[model samples]
Target: MISSSRCTHLLLLLPLMFSFFVMGFVDLVGIASNYAKADYQLTDTTANFLPSLVFFGFLLFSVPTSILMNKIGRKRTLLLSLCVTMAALLLPVFNKSFAGMLAAFSLLGIGNTLMQTSVTPLLSTVVSDDELSSALTFGQFVKAIASFLAPLIAAWGVHYNVFGMNWRILFVAYMLIAVLAVMVLSATPFSDEKPADTSGLRSTFALMRRPMVCGCFIGILCHVGIDVGINATAPRIFQEYEGLSLTHAGRITSFYFICRTVGCLLGTFFLSRVSNRRFFVLSVVCIMCGLIGFAGFRSETALYLCVALIGLGNSNVFSITLTQALQSCPEYKNEVSGLMIMGLFGGTIFPLAMSMTSDGIGSQLGAVAVMLVAAAYLLFFAFKIQGKR
Candidate 1:
């Protein structure tokens, strides 16, 4: 029979894991931006702005959200985020204008920013240090489930005209899930650890002065830049190189997430048995190889293979780098969480940069070049992780 303590632990974890699914909602921005571009007849640079707007909140709101968590606790902050996400998802269903969609995505970014900042540290509160990496990987695995599903669901909605919503059905479906997440998480009790001291923006920024914290911050920046970069660009690559329709090209994004989902599932077990530094180095190598393939190959098959490499390799980067930063300064997990999450603003920087580079060069190779630079930084970061030990 299960002990009450063990049962309670599982109970606590289930809600948090579901929250990770909610966190995955932000990834919809990729396919959604593509769809929005097609619908509005937008230029590549203008379409890129959708995702940039979505992630821009990380730069503006992450540190403040951490400060908010200190006052209200992580659980409450998480709930607020879910509520905002619900609003975001609900908006496009009613307002189909481009401006309306822009507003919706902006709210989605802000909500996700709040959720991302709070959820990982909140997970640390429930699990011990040893289990944290595995737990975080597992959480990402759950998140990837939602991430991979977004494109599939959008495609399904477009094909079937589900409830006459077309692609906007993605918003409705996710809104319902966000509502469910809010309900389930609200009902479950979490013992939120109050921060030992208050954290302001200044103190949060100061955490970056520490080498491990700074390196991990850049690691996160590169990790997210690549993740968002691929999500936003892969489908276009398919279209440019293979002459595929938007619907067909969209599957490329789903395929990337599918590979990532598999990698995260495998990582959950592997991280428990292996050292983070070793696993991290291997993951970075996979991404570097994938990016190299992207630059050199033009075949559909070759591109798909490269996507798989990147997805698998990048699957556990966020968890590993985050765990490193949190472990580096156990006392300031909240502040560090904020600073590290702020690195996600790299999502904004990368897509805009990639878009301009690709547009200027008149080839997707320019975008691949940008991601290769990010991959190279991750490779360098692997050495830093080793040095930390």
Candidate 2:
């Protein structure tokens, strides 16, 4: 049986896990919203604003919240983040204005940025090393679950006719998960100790200069961009290019995430046998091939294979990146983690940039091009590390 202390700490994982529900919706629809925006009589540029707005909040809020955790400790930061996460998800229920949804996404981004930075350190405080990757990968499993489930959520709302639209009901359920997460974290026994002395703004960069740290940070940015890239584009590729309805397309999208969750589960076992550095390199190669496959072909079966491959290939990235970043600075765990998540500012803006570029180029294939760029960097990082080793 798990100890009561361990149980209490693990309970906190629920809120962090659930925040992805709001995040998944925002992440998955980066490209799909082109359809929604057009349906609602909006410009492609205006539609692309949702993703940029979300990450903008991440950029603005990540460091301050990380410092707050240092001074006040994990639990309070978590509660505040969880509440914001819930509010962010629920805002669309009452207000459907494009600008309002953008505001909500911004709040959600800030909430997620805090959760992303704090919860891993919080989990590290709780779980043993044997279970560390397990817990982290399990979070990925839940994240994939949220991503996979989100499209169905959008579909269900369509079937039932909520908010004169479909995806709004999806946000309703995401808000409920956020509430449940908050309740669990409130009851958990996480510590209130300061995380780090992040009071000085100059410290953020001073903290960033450790060898391999920037690579690790940039690695996360690229990986998130890649992960978000697939989630963002998979639906449209499956629906428009593959010719499926919202529901059927959603089911196929779910398969990609299911494969991702499985990859992480499998990664926990393999980490004992393989080095993370090697795994990340191979995963990037596999993802490169997957995206290139999508670019090369139009067959539905092939699309499913490629999408699942994309998730399976890169599922280990976040854990691998975080582990390396922290391992590089064993003492400065929370600060490093904060800087790493703050790097996710790229995930938000990159997708929106891709969308706008697609507008000018007259093809969403610009999404694929954005992905190849990320993969190229991954390959370069992998090579750079190999040269050093």
Candidate 3:
């Protein structure tokens, strides 16, 4: 009977976890930006704006989505996000104009922002406190599966001439999955805890005053900044050093995500037994090494090694940081989740800084330097977590 109940619990959790895969749809912006660059003949700085647009929604919608979850409930909020994402994916299918692509990506960002704000908190409700970090890490592993697939699927679309739609057909494939996620999650019943206190922008901002909260917020900022930075910059490194075409350079991007997927899969078990602080410190060191190697090394093999290190190091930072914050202040999970998701605005800030620097220096190494600074900040954040849960 106990095993039966556990199986039932696992069955229900499956669909919620699938939503993490849907959340990964936002990462399509990286490859999509490259496609846009080729098609529009835009400069690197201008092409970079596409990713900036996708993440900009995090700045505008994360906090509000948190507040909305309080009123409507997490599962319902997730469904809303899925619907928005479906709409976003459909737009580019019919029209490939720059304006149409921008509109589609904007909606993609908004939906992903809402999904990020609500989905993890919803997962937290399902699992016990002790399991939160591991569960979230596993969720990240699932998300990385989708991330790693984006470029491959786009490349496949171009190769097979599927639907005569080019890489935009990736959107069509994901739209169908989004519809399935909506249906499954809607039918699965989740008990949402009512808000005990009214939360708004003021209260959410007030969390920054707490040293721990502030540190975690900055930790998330650096983690996401690095994640987006690597996603946007890795391909360029291959292109510059090896003279690989965009299609082949994309394999390096997939390699980074593959390492991340494996790292998160391992982290799901290790985090449950190892102290979060110890593991986090180790991960930060790995990222710093990767950053230094990426900045200094010009050889193809060396650069690939560095990319793998960074991916492995970064895989669990978000899950670890977020779970620690929620555990410390269990009362304000919604607000904390909102603030953490807002830290994803680092996605916007880091890529823009990298773009500007890469343009000025006339080398991809300039962009790597920006990530080095982000990595240094993560090193500091790791120290602060030494004795923390």
Candidate 4:
């Protein structure tokens, strides 16, 4: 029988994990970027601005959100993030103007930045140290469930014309879920970490003095860059090489997310028994092979196989890198969490780079070239983690 205290703890953990799903709402930027590109007849460079705008919020808001958490408490901060997310989703429903979407994507980034700043550290308080890595990976699995669904939902909205609205209906559906998440989380009570003095940007920067912290920070950048890069480019790859229509090509994005969702689900179990260093290196190698195979081959079957490989390989890198930073400076979890999430600006950096490279070379192969560089960095990071356990 479950003890009362254990039951209470489980209740607290549920809402915190549910917020991870909310955190994933930002991934919609990937498919939304393509939709906007089609609607506007945008160049690769211009359409990428949608995703770039979304991640740019991470650069501007992440550290401040951490400081805000220290002042307001993590739970209240999380609620604030949800409120911001709801507002962002509503903007598109009311007006689908280009400027309106830019604003919506920016707010979406800000809300997700705030949620990422608080959610993991908040989860750490409920679970034990030894359990932290696997627990976070499970949180990631929940997050991927949302990421996996975004493209499918967008595709459905496009096809069915739900509510006489098109892809914008995806925002409406997500906004409703956000409202539910907020209500459930606000009603639940959990003990908060006492506010910390190290919330300042100066102190957050100081933590970079630690070698592992810096390495993990860059590792995060590469992980998110590749994740977002693949998401934004997968459909285009199909369109460019196979001459498929956008609606049909969009399924490739869904396929990538499907593999990623499965990878995170498996990671939660394997991470319990396998050394993180060992598992991380193997994952990196899988992506490296995928990228190289992609650069060399254009066959439809090879494309599908390599994309699935990239998805499976990239899946656990974020959770693993994040848990490493948190464990490295357990006392500084809040500050470190902010700095690491700030690295998500890589989502902005890579997509823009991929865009220009594609434009410069006049092919999606330029984007593939950019991802290969990202995969190479992850491989090097993998070796850095060897024997650390």
Worst 10 residues of 2 by lDDT: 26-35
Spell out the clash pairs found in candidate 1. Answer: none
Order of models, best lDDT first: 1, 4, 3, 2
Residue-level lDDT tens digits of model 3 in 273-387: 7888899988989999998997778899999999999999999999888877777678888998888898888888889899999999899888888998998988888877745
Query: CA lDDT of 120 in candidate 4?
Result: 81
**Model 2, range 100-214, lDDT digits (tens) per residue?**
7777878878878877777777777667766676777777777777777766667777788886766678778777877777776676665545543455556766877776788
- Candidate 2: stretches off by over 4 Å: 1-35, 162-165, 195-199, 243-252, 384-389
Identify the candidate with maximal lDDT: 1
Error of 4 at 134 (Å): 1.2
Quote the positional error of residue 240 for candidate 4 in Å.
Answer: 1.0
Write down the lDDT that model 4 would get.
Answer: 0.88
Indicate the TM-score of model 3.
0.97
Which of 2 and 3 is the better model by TM-score? 3
The segments of candidate 3 whose C-alpha lies over 4 angstroms from its true place after superposition are 386-389
Residue lDDT tens for model 1, 66-129 = 9999999999999999999999999999999999999998999999999999999889879997
Error of 4 at 274 (Å): 1.4
For 1-389, candidate 4 gives per-residue lDDT tens digits of 99998999889988988899998898889989999998888999999999999899889998888888888888999999999999999999998789999999999999999999989878877988877777788888888888878888888989999998888888999999999999999899878887535467888898999988999989998899999999989888888878888878888888888898899988988887788889898899888888787778888899999899999999999988887887788888888889999999999999999999999999888988998888888788877774544
The count of residue-pair clashes in candidate 1 stands at: 0
What's the TM-score of each model vs. the native? 0.98, 0.89, 0.97, 0.98
lDDT at position 379, candidate 4: 80
Candidate 4 stretches greater than 4 Å from native: 386-389
- State each candidate's clash count: 0, 1, 0, 0
